[model samples]
Target: MKISIYREKLKDKINNKKAKIAVIGLGYVGLPLAVEFAKKGFFVFGIDIDKKKIKALSRGNSYIQDIKRTALSELLSNKLISFSCDYRNIVKSDIIIICVPTPLRKTREPDISYVVEATRKIKDNVKKGQLVILESTTYPGTTEEILLVLFSERGLKVGQDFFLAFSPERVDPGNRVFNTSNITKVVGGVSKNCAYLSKLIYSKIIPQVILVSSSKVAEMTKLLENTFRAVNIALINEIALMCDKLKINIWEVIEAAKTKPFGFMPFYPGPGLGGHCLPVDPLYLSWKSRRHGFEPRLIELASQINSHMPNHVVNKVVELINSKAKHSILEANILIVGVTYKRDICDIRESPSIDIIRMLLEKQANVSYYDPYVSQLPIGKKSLHSIKLTKKNIFGFDCVVIVTDHAKIDYSFILKNSKLIFDTRNVFKKFNNSKVFRL
Candidate 1:
């Protein structure tokens, strides 16, 4: 009877546009989510520990690439959203969403300290008749084991006095196709009331809301999604290496295989896997699996292959310099184009281009890079700036390697003036020239 009354009250607040929504950890995921809710006519509070982010948002500015500045300014003008670095705002919010990052430690173990700490802050200000949902990705059983314990310690009767759920975030940075409004959101909770209430809140802003049986299922769903990508990427990368020895272009083979359209999904080969999801999410699952005495052999093997790709690229550079250029690697003037992890983004987290640049510098090569999105690289112990992409700059290098293929670059200008080119991303597929090489 008590659970029904609380559920009705929450549902009424959401339907009438009176619910005060709070989103914690305003980052790539949280900022867009908070904006989406505000766009849907709900009052929102954007909370984070970073004062710089809060200050910027308070001025009607957006730091995330996916969110537009005009939309943020409009929300601020309408008084639908506000930013804060305080946790006391959570007490007044009827629904709270956690969107903190779950990164790996230096030892490659799952570092869930951010999630745990966020839960502690939430517990301190939680009130009855409120709903809490976690959107950070982690191993299975994290919501049930870690978050539930914290709420329980507060003496709140969940499903009656409070509601808890897990809804993993599927944020793809720099992806223009899918955003927060259209993507399908999968939600799981500790009880039916929890799942229903959480689904109602998300349904107001998202296109689809899927309800699962338990929070553990939602957590595992996120891991499986990324692990599948990591494993397939490793498979295709190994195939690319083999294609090099067989004197066949892997890109050509992939283009032909993609014609069948049934049993094949094209996963491209690059220097290696980068970004927050592909390189880090798989290890979280494998680490958890090992605790139960189960060996995830496939996951480990994929990680090994992906991790060694930077070295493979370095070896290719050495071979190219030895066979074509007059100077050794120690005396070469190598230029790398594009340093970000992927194309058309400014984020540099776990980028393979950094490792490739470090390796080239270790061999005494005079290396310089040019990226239109990134103006400078502040790597460890050394800082390099992006050089201009003129004919004079192109002609001065021993070879130019295309590490990332941003659309804004003038590739024809480089090809017309460069002496030799090593293309890791197959950016020179249209031109047939003796000076161009593909990986």
Candidate 2:
């Protein structure tokens, strides 16, 4: 058979966990996944352009919250994993996985430059009998549009001389329950042989594997997952704004709806959508949708509502400052309790707290923050350090805003010490203090 040469060789290497795997872009998603592959006794080659990351990983120091330093040490001790900045090392690898970022441009269109660049590097070093799978979250046609064409330029036929697949990574930062070993790995490929080889490799580390028909379906699957959450969160955010106008408590409404337990999945409103998937993925889908001559109005509306939340939060603070404080808004002291995008993680990408602080400062309000995970934040030219969350520090502020409710923060202590509070995360739901206001 024509497929016997590449398929059988890959099957044997994967079955023995002897496959030389190369995982690119060691960030939130890439680092943890690379570690998992190492644990399974695979000779994993970790590649990234960041020397700081390579230095840390090479010395067995982990910068990500989810991957532990001890895991790196064990992997390094066994010589199961190696880190490098050079792409030429991939010439000896049997599999290459791309986990690079897919960000948006100033026009809000999908930016696949990172994906293209990674492909170009792979193109230079790509060899026959190597399986290339892209795990970066992108548009539907990206795998075929970029990977296949680039790799084939050097006369390597995909699925014959080399295998090609798209496996969308389902990595949730700080999610303890579903890590790489347990979550379902969704694989789709350009050909059945490509999908089979990809599944054989990923099945060595991940427990459940689902192979779809084509790479586009796998790409669309990942987008649909994030878009679903983005749209629903937007719907609830708009409802929260409606409740603010009607003197209704959105939290209480969500609690009431939770009793039914059927058809109602609660998505809380916040300063806005944060993290990588929710804010960015839907826009990828939307960009593709527009190109196909279809308008995703609801998705666009959701983005608008979620984006407006920080402004709404600022408006509430303005109302409180005018109503409760003797000082003018110019010199009012506003302390932000937490600064990270989500609770318990150091990730600050696309965080709404940044917007809230900027809006506050633009209003000439004094803004300082406290986050155990983040030490300091940059705004324009100046920087704001995480002040000590002491009683004296808490009392000095005119109003304290609970933007992110990290698990480590003492809510009761803050409630007792703050002069006035605007609770965005419902950290004060149990409290009956007259001075505590909730969004």
Candidate 3:
């Protein structure tokens, strides 16, 4: 078939809800996206290497907090969406989206192995006239440099025999307002037809589809968005440290500055930068910049500041314990309020609470955690479970550190019971008490 004819056929299938949409890696990003596509009347297939996730989805259950179980059950019952561990589904898909993770290595460099592995699977099973879109977050030139080479090596001509594009996944896991269907989708392709086909597919489920000039542009767009967040968060964290030394409440200062409403956007300080995006994405940009003979000093510095926050929090805990408790840190019983990276979410990937727990353990402190969302914490070799937050358990601890300010926690109960409270998230700013120490 001619290239134009293939493009027109794919576009028609997308518009008429007849396209088989396959989403690879059904974790935080892929599950919600696959559900949205299926809800819009598209036949969606979800692929994942984790058998546990496959089994759960096959049984019409959702592991992700953002994806409701009822919604997933309805789609599974209607036969609009299916789950699989086999790569054979790629052959039947008209549009395939790769939502695999792009995490950092131990050396803090971009680990594109997951993206590469998923692309290789697509290269093996993909057929002619199929559209492949990379939704994984990575450095610039990934779609063109990595994916384009893979397809070309398989003797497939992109934009002719098959379509190729990059559309960054803008998923905020615990966010209630903006979701997969509401957030604007940004897409770019190696060729105009590739971009157009991707935009058509996303427009069916998304509110808006932004078409960029090229795939590299779309990749850089994601990096810029997260890098902006990382940099500003580091700036605010440093200010909070300064405010602590000067005896000024950083939360009050932020409130005063936020009233301007023109130039300043408030970013609260925390134990550290956590989650899948802020801590990992900026380093991908910095790593790519170093390859081109440019060092991203600001980004590197921001990472350093944010990385030190866990230590800073640990130091404050020690200081408060030394001053208030009759016993040293080694003998003190410490309790952590929340272990997840953010509030109202169960995701603990790259959470700074893990680092804080490790630091406290090294100091020989008796540490326990209470998160309504997370039930267990698996460290290097030991497994810690969440303790029940009773009045006796609350008062028994010498120090209670609020790492993640989850809304569901009883702040009044904590304030009335705990001996000394270290508020890393500034949750007790409104209540002025001698026992509460703000970070």
Leading candidate by lDDT: 3
Question: Looking at model 1, which ten-residue stretch has the lowest summed lDDT?
Answer: 1-10
Query: Residue 346 deviation, candidate 1, in Å?
Result: 0.9
Per-residue CA lDDT of model 1 for 1-439, tens digit only, reads 2356888999999999999999999988899999999999999999999999899999988877788899999999999999999999999999999999899999999999999999999999998899999999899989889988999999988888889999999978778898888899999988889999999999999979999999999999999999999999999999999999999999999999999969899998889888788899999999999999999999999999998999999899989998998679996999999998999888888899999999999999999999998888976799999999999999999999999999889999999989999998999999999999988
Q: Which stretches of candidate 2 lie over 4 Å from their true place?
A: none
2 or 3, which is superior by lDDT?
3
Q: Backbone clashes per model, in order? A: 0, 0, 0
Tell me which residue pairs clash in candidate 3: none
Tens digit per residue, CA lDDT, model 3, 315-335: 999998998886799968999
TM-scores across all candidates? 0.98, 0.98, 0.98
Residue 162 Cα positional deviation in candidate 3, in Å, after optimal superposition: 0.9
- Model 3 gets an lDDT of 0.93
The alpha-carbon deviation from the true structure for residue 189 of candidate 1, after best TM-score superposition, in angstroms, is 1.2
Question: CA lDDT of 80 in candidate 3?
Answer: 99
The segments of candidate 3 whose C-alpha lies over 4 angstroms from its true place after superposition are 1-3
Ranking under lDDT, best-scoring first? Answer: 3, 1, 2
User: How large is the C-alpha RMSD of every model relative to the true structure?
Assistant: 1.3, 1.1, 1.3
User: Between candidates 1 and 2, which one is better according to TM-score?
Assistant: 2
TM-score comparison, 1 vs 3, better candidate: 3
